[model samples]
Target: MIVNLGDQLFMQLQLRGTIWTQTITNLRTNWAVNFSIDLLGQSQNYLYFRIEQYGSTFVDDAVYLNSKWKFARPSNQGCTLAFRGIKDFVSTPQLSADGLSCSVVKIIQRAKENPRPGF
Candidate 1:
């Protein structure tokens, strides 16, 4: 499948009063198949992501807390996930007006440049 120039995707999980968010942007679908991910929640300092591609499943895990975060993978299937973190005081907030929680934020998935062929 060809993802075109600027496509987006995401996986979200609501767990125990907390929501885990992940997003992919600027996606290129060349050499890819069956791409999806699920947030298995966090443990200690590690955020676990379960990724499924081409019938194979694995984890893209990272150790991060109270900081900006991003994750990307390129293979027969490719993915890019990002978090804007906290905006500076002088800068306008993207997700919320009051501010954002380091633990929980919003996740969005959309086709920025082009949508899939068949509506």
Candidate 2:
């Protein structure tokens, strides 16, 4: 989900017999753009994502961050993402012994907009 500063997005996923929820928050006081994947209730052993700037106007100063789980079960978790000024535009998944895979089923983006009633 894409979120600007002061905004929060919540997502829930169900896997096996458990339901897990993830909440992402943009803590910057200024406008910040980011994308996140929540593998809350998933059993996947690995996850990865690649970011490409579609236009030349896209500046290299933009920063992106990501977090994920590294173990077969949720008990062993890991989080890593590129910081500002970093050159790596892709993230590699840290997999578990089971070597499972994950597919993105749904995505939701929330951006703050002027409040309007009954549009």
Which candidate leads the pack in lDDT? 2
For model 1, what is the error of residue 73's alpha carbon versus the real structure, in angstroms, after optimal superposition? 30
TM accuracy, model 2 = 0.28
The TM-score of predicted model 1 comes to 0.20
lDDT score, candidate 1 = 0.28
TM-score for each model: 0.20, 0.28
Q: Write the per-residue lDDT of candidate 2 for residues 44-109, one digit (tens) a residue.
A: 533333233345333222223333333444333332322212232333535444543222222212
How many clashes (backbone atoms < 3 Å, residues ≥3 apart in a chain or on different chains) does model 2 have?
0
Segments of candidate 1 deviating more than 4 angstroms: 16-44, 48-100, 103-119
Give residue 38's error in model 2 in angstroms: 12
Candidate 2 achieves a global lDDT of: 0.34
Residue-level lDDT of model 1, residues 1-119, one tens digit each, is 43432344333333343444333433344232343334455432334332234553323221121222322221221112233223211112122222322223332222231211110
